[model samples]
Target: MSTTFWIIIAGAIATYLTRIGGHLVISRFDNIHPRVEAGLNAVPAAVLTTLVAPELLNAGPAEWAALVVTAVVSLRGGLMAMFLAGAAVLILARQFVG
Candidate 1:
């Protein structure tokens, strides 16, 4: 909409180009450093731990209730039921609190 918007668009383009260029440059390798490979291998577990660790560490009573509902819904009917159960919890909480 303005000069700053254009600059942001250019920045995004530059960032995308750098990402593609980096992958093209690095993926050409026949062999890579073992440490680099090991770091890459740990990335998935690291991301999952970071995402779940906060919830696990700081969960309160309400969170425990939600977690129990989510687990049961997920086990019985997968993600859809879990989402519905979460919405139900929020609505029920609002009914009592508000």
Candidate 2:
């Protein structure tokens, strides 16, 4: 196999093993450490903030409104709901505000 092909296979196998290892570790734990639990809980918010923070800093009004809608939806809804709400708000904001 080519070196690049071997690299890709190695990456895929590493990803699969890491995911399975997490499951195996969690299954053995009757209760996770509080700090570990807290870190896990913070991951989604941290990821969302990282994703949105740059856009927020540079956003025009419509983008700002869309982000606000997303935040609100995130509080009371799931990811898909928040995404849809944000997209809908963006569409409307563009149509009306532009």
Q: Cα RMSDs of all predictions? A: 5.0, 3.8
TM-score of 2: 0.64
Write candidate 1's Cα lDDT for 1-98 as tens digits.
99999999999999898779858877799888999989978988899778866886776555656667777788778778897896687567656654
Best by TM-score: 2
Model 2 C-alpha lDDT versus the unseen true structure: 0.90
Tell me the lDDT of candidate 1. 0.78
List lDDT for all candidates, in order. 0.78, 0.90
Each prediction's total of clashing residue pairs, residues at least 3 apart in sequence or on different chains, is: 0, 0
lDDT of 2 by residue, 11-46 (tens): 999989978988888879898899999999998789
Per-candidate TM-scores read 0.45, 0.64
RMSD in angstroms between candidate 2 and the native structure over all alpha carbons: 3.8
The weakest ten consecutive residues by lDDT in model 2 span 48-57
lDDT of 2 at 79: 86
